[model samples]
Target: MKKLIESLLRQALSALPVSRVPPDARPAEVDVERTRDAAHGDFASNLAMRLAKTTRQNPRALAEALIDALPGHPAVAKTEVAGAGFINFFLKDTAYYDEVARILADSGQYGRSDQGGGRSVLLEFVSANPTGPLHVGHGRHAAYGATLGNLLEAVGYRVTREYYVNDAGRQMEILAVSTWLRYLERCGETLEFPANGYRGDYIATIAGQLHEAVGGELRRAAAEVFSGLPADEPRGGDKDAYIDALIARARALIGTDAFRRVLSVALDDILRDIQQDLGEFGVRFDRWFSERSLEDDGSVDRALAALEKAGHAYRRDGALWFKSSAFGDEKDRVMVRDNGVKTYFASDIAYIFNKLARGFDHLLYVWGADHHGYIARLRAGLVALGGPAGCFEVRLVQFVSLYRGGEKAQMSTRSGEFVTLRDLRREVGNDAARLFYVMRSNDQHLDFDLELATSRSNENPVFYIQYAHARVASVMRQMQGRGLEHDGRQGLARLGLLVEPQEVALMKRLSQYPETVEQAALQRAPHLLVHYLRDLANDFHTNYSAHQLLVDDPALRDARLTLSLAAQTVIRNGLGILGVSAPESM
Candidate 1:
């Protein structure tokens, strides 16, 4: 409906004489908006007032001229010049009646559009490290990213979902050592675990697996493992320094090859678990990028070489540094330490370079809110490597606070005292989990109420929407039981019978689906679609309650059924985008 009005307005503008309205005064794009008040009109535009000053004419007079030049269309009942030269359009009832037929015809493809124009996007999200299992927080990231990808593809964007594996870092080393310590304990060697080590129960389970794989082959005496090492945090020493020294000792005693074997075993086990968890949650990635691959493929060296050739890198105090401050970062960042090891920041830079080298039109990163400070240096790396500044984007997802009953549940990944995504899914079905996770904007803090989500009532938004779809199915069954059959052809021919206030209201809501999807995709907000579905469900319920679908008049009954089916189609399509099911029987 908005597009139709805009097209008519464009025709009117082209018909206007150039002497009265200069080409510069004409808007490049026509903007038509639905009026808030029914008394004004169905839609309104302020084109005349916008062009008045440039055209050297009175606003009201210009509006009259533009209205006169508008071509006649059956959808428009009348056009009026309101106060301040606003052009108001009162649409005919047939405009909305035809939209119902369009909806049923399009079915699953009704709300889709080609707004993105085939642009390519590389969307990276939920790239949690393989140090531990994914908790409730990562679950929110997965749901939001998956739905956002669906919304993007609906609007015609070519999207590639990715999860970057943080496989090369101190965190991985710590996990490896944690597993080894537990392994030694299982081999009759008792030792106090480091305060800074991963104390999760999963670490012990991995150690059991290691014992099953190589029994006592990698085990060492507790004295040899902890001897001469710095005091641990529990003993009033720096935990970071103690953990680093312990890692070095482990490598020395067991050899680097053996140490890497432990790391590889732990890494493979945890990564496999992550893959299974996400797969069950209906989140799949096109690629699982490895940070170590940047080093293995010489991409990091190439990135450093690019930076140096572009005069953005220099050596200072025995360390290679990137001039990040020149590109809007707070300070210069070191690419390589004085000890000849590349820093994580260097891998970050090369990662962005590799993404751009893949010929993506845009790079979108979904990161935690804490990583907000890292955006500048990363963008600096892109620009220093000669990528467009506008091609890079980041969306920060806030933390999630899980609530069971009234008390807020506390979570810590290192201690493994947290709720996993799989745990949440098991308690509440995936439909409810997916819907509840994205019930708010990504940047807004979410308090997921497990009790409310499990309830089977209208208070739950997912239940309300799915019930609306089921009611239509029930209506069809009831009609069949009454020995009647709906004739859609005749109903479409007799759509003029649908003149009730509830019918008009429902049809108006149905016509807004395409626009709602386009706006939601452009803003990258799934909550907008969530809000729209709720309102649509409310509208469907109100109409169903106020009228009867299986009436005596065959034409009216089929017409009502057509409307009901259109609503069902839209509900199914909307829920499909959110990765939630729309069931026929609630």
Candidate 2:
């Protein structure tokens, strides 16, 4: 419908006299938008006002001339100039009737479009380190990224959802050492767990699995493992240095091969756990891009070489530094330290290079709010490596606070006290969790109220939208119970019988689905879709309450039934994109 109005406006512009609308004054693109109020019209365009400055004419006079030159169309019942030369288009009822029929015909494909022009997009998200279970915060990233990928795909973008596994970092080594310490405890050896170690109970679970695999063969005496080790933070020592020393001692005591096996076991187990958690949450990645693979495949060296050749890299104080400050970063970043270890930033740039090499037109990163500072350096690195600056983008998701009843729920991943995504799903179910996670904008903090989400009332947006769908199904079943069969062809043929104010309003809202989806996808905002579904469901519920869907008149009954089915289809499609199910019954 928006496209139709734009086309008509373009025709009107071309029909105008060359003196009134010169070639240079004419707009290359017409901007048609839905009117906020019913009194204004179905759609409105400010083309006349936009051209007024260039043409040196009064906007109202230009609008009148454009309306006079506007070509006639059956779908547009009338066009009127409103405040400040706004051309409002009042669409005919037949137009909305046709839209309802189109909705029925398209079914699941109704709200999608090819607006993206088939551009390739690489979406990297929730690449949480595999050292612990995914807490509630990671759940947001998973849901947001997954739904955003769905939205992008719906709009015809070739999207590749990816998870960058931080498997090559020091965190994994700490996890291995943590597991080994627990293994020694299983062998009746006493040791003080490092403050920096991953102390999650899942670590002990992994330790038990390690024990089952290798028994006490890898165990060393607690004294030997902790001998000559620096005091931990609890004893006024740097926890980082202490953990590194502990890791070295473990390797020396158990041999490098044994240490590697332990690290592999912990990494594989935790990563599998993460994969399962996300899979169950309806979030699946096309690839789990390994950080270790970047180094293994020599991509890091290549990226560094690109930076060096571009004259964006230089050595300073025995460290290889990228001149990120040259590209607007606050300070230069070290890609490799004096100790000859590549920083995580090095792997990050390598990952960006990999994405570019894979031929993605755009690289979208979904990162936690804490990673906001890293975005500048990463983008600077991308530019330094000769990638287009506009091709890289980052979305920061704010923190999520879980609330049970009225009290804020505390969470800590290191201490294993956090609420896992699985736990949230099991308690509130996936439908509610998925909806609640994206109910607010990504940049806004989410206070996930446990009690409100599980409720089966209007207060819960998921249940309300789903109930609207279920109500339509109930109407269909009730019609069948009364020995009245719905003829879709008959319903579509008699759509003119839908004359009630509620019916017209519902149809108008239904027609906005495609536009709503397109706007949501273009803005990269899933919350807009959530709000639209709520509005759509509200319209459906209002019409259902005000009118009789299963009436005695067969034509009117079937017409309303068709409308109900169309509403159900749209509701289902929207929920599906959000990874929430649309139930047929409450």
Candidate 3:
């Protein structure tokens, strides 16, 4: 209805000669908003008011002119210029009913269109460090990213979901140190732990697994590990302390340099655990790209060189700095320290290049909200590297607060108290978890209420939408059990009989599904689908509570069943795009 109205308005405007009113500078948007009062008409738009200033006339007068120019169309039965130049169009009574036929005709393909024009987009998200298990924040990101990718694909953007692993940073080094230290503890080596390191039982589990795999085969320890000096200072606070202790032990038994080899055993364990833990969360990335690969392949160095040559970089404090303020940043950033170690921002620069080189038309970074400041730096880096600034984009998601037992769920990986993605999924089930995570917008804070998500009642979206589908299936089954027959062809032919106001209302809601998908995909908003599905289910439930689908009245039965089937198809499609299942039975 909105598109038809907008198309009509555009056509009407195009017919006016520029000589008459001098073409309106402001473009018009035909928004078909549902009327709060039936007396106002069905879908209302402010096309005339929007055009008033451009046409140099009073809004009411412009509205009257727009109405006069409206062509006769079957879909729009009447157009009235209401108060303040609002153009409200009453959809034809038959048009509402015909949508039911269209629904049955299109079936599952009802809400999908090829609007992407073959553009390819890359979505990178949930790239949690391998130092520990994925926590609740990453869980929200995984759900949002996967659904966004799915939504884009539905609307025809060639999409790739990626996870760029930062496996070569200080964090990874800390993880390695922590694991080796835990190995020393298992081997009865006495060493002080670091003030800051990864804790949690998984570290020990990885250490034990590594020890079992390579117990006596690898020898030496003590001073050899601690040979790196800071032996006088506390090594670390968590698992890294344990690793530093083991390195000290290695240095004691062998030498300073050989202590580095001890990290291999720890790194292997961390990698294995990280893979298994996230794999359980249903977040499989097309790439687990290593930050190390960028440096190893000279990509990071090359990126720095390009930025330096472009005057986007400068040497300061014996370190390389990026002049990000030229593009828009609070201040310059360090690309490399005097010690020759590249900054994480430098890695991001290389990583983006890698993504673009793979042929993605656009690169999307889904980062936690804490990294909001990094946005300007990344954008500036892309420009400094001689790449178009439009190539890279970032979406910072606000924190998700998980509540259970009416108290805040405090999460810290170092204490092993954080809620792992696996734990959240196991408790709430994947469907509910995914739904809850995306229930709110990305920029808004989310309180993932555990009790609400676990409920199997209609108040719960997981069950509510599923129930609509199952109820429809139940009706279809009743028809089949009664030995009645129908298919899309018969359903479309008999849909005109579905004339009840409730039936027409339900069908009208179904007709809006395509636009909902298009808008949601365009805005990269999956919550819109959640809202649409809930509303669609409300319509279904209302119709179910008031009407009968399998009556002795064949004509009415056929019409109702067709409408029900159409609802089922759309509900399933919407749910499918969110990686959710619409069950035929609860």
Candidate 4:
């Protein structure tokens, strides 16, 4: 409908005489937008205001000329030059009636578009390290990313949902050593666990599995393991150094191959857990790209080589450095340290190169807000490697603070005290979890109120939206109980009977679904869709509360039913994108 209005305005502008509106004064695109006030009409455009300055004519006069030139269309009931220069378009009642018919006909496919132009987008998100189970924070990323992916896909983008597994480097090593220590304990060898090592009970579970797989063959005596180890953090030593030393000592005792086995076991177990958790949350990825694979395939070396070839790399203080500052970063970054170990940034660069090599027109990274500083360096690295600066984008999701009964819920992943995504989903349900996770802007801190999410009330947006869907179903069932079948054909034919204010409002809201989806996708804002759903649900509920659908008048009853069904279809489609279920019975 917006397109139809825009097209009419564009044709009107083009048909105008050059003397009144010059070729140079024409806009590349018409700007038709929904009016906030019903008195202003269904849709309005500021084309005249935009062209007035260029055409050297009064905006109101230009608006009048534009309106006069507009070709007559059945959908447009009238066009008025309103306050100053806006062209307000009052859509005909039949237009909305046709929209209701279209909604019923399209069903689940409604509100989708081909606006993406088939561009390939590699959306990498929630690439939280596989060292621990995903927590409440990761749950937000999962919901936001998954919904964003669904939105983009709905708009015809070839979106590849990816989870980059940080399965390499110090963190994974710490996890391996942590698993080994726990395995040793399982083998009856008591040793003090490192302060910086993973201490989650899940690690102990993995350790038990390891013991079952290899018995005590991979275990060493506690004395031998901690005999000459440096003081741990609890003993007034650097936790990072202590953990690193423990990892080395474990490798020496178990041998390099056995150490790799331990690392692989821990990595696979935790990765599997994360994959399962996200999958159960309705967040599936097209690929789980491994950081280890980047090194194993020589992509890291190749990426470094590319930097060096482009004169963006230099050696200083026995470390290979990339001149990231040259491309607008605050400072240069080290790619490889003095110990010949590559930094996580090195793997990130390789990952970027790998993504580019795969032919993605755009690369979007969903990262934690704390990683804001890393964006500049990563973009610099991409540009240093000759990738287009515009191709790289980052969206930082702020922290999610869980609250229960108005008290903050504290969490720490390393201490094994954090609320896992599984726990959250179990507590509030996947539908509520998904909806609440994305109810706010990604960059805005979210206080996920557990009480509100679980409450079966109108205040809960998820429940409210789902209820709107179920209300329509209940109405249909009631109609059936009264021995009246919903004749969709007859309902569609009698759409003209739906002329009440509430009915018109609901029809208008339904028509905005496609626009809402498109706007949310383009803006990378899932919160927009959430707010839209809330408003849409409110419209449906308002209409339902005021109007009686099962009336003695067959045509009016079916017309109202048709409108309700359309609302239900749109709510279902929106909820589906957000990974929230629209239950028939809320």
Worst 10 residues of 2 by lDDT: 18-27
RMSD of 1: 1.6
Model 4 Cα displacement at 168 (Å)? 1.0
**What tens digits encode model 2's per-residue C-alpha lDDT throughout 375-395?**
999999888877899999999
Residue 345's C-alpha lDDT in candidate 2?
Answer: 94
Q: State which candidate, 1 or 2, has the greater TM-score.
A: 2
Cα-based RMSD of candidate 2:
1.2
* Candidate 4, 94-136: lDDT as tens digits: 9988888898888999999999999999999999999888999
Higher-TM-score candidate of 3 and 4: 4
Stretches of candidate 4 off by over 4 Å are none
lDDT of each: 0.92, 0.92, 0.78, 0.92
355, model 3: CA deviation in Å?
2.5
Global CA lDDT computed for model 1? 0.92
Query: Where is model 1 poorest over a 10-residue stretch in terms of lDDT?
Result: 48-57
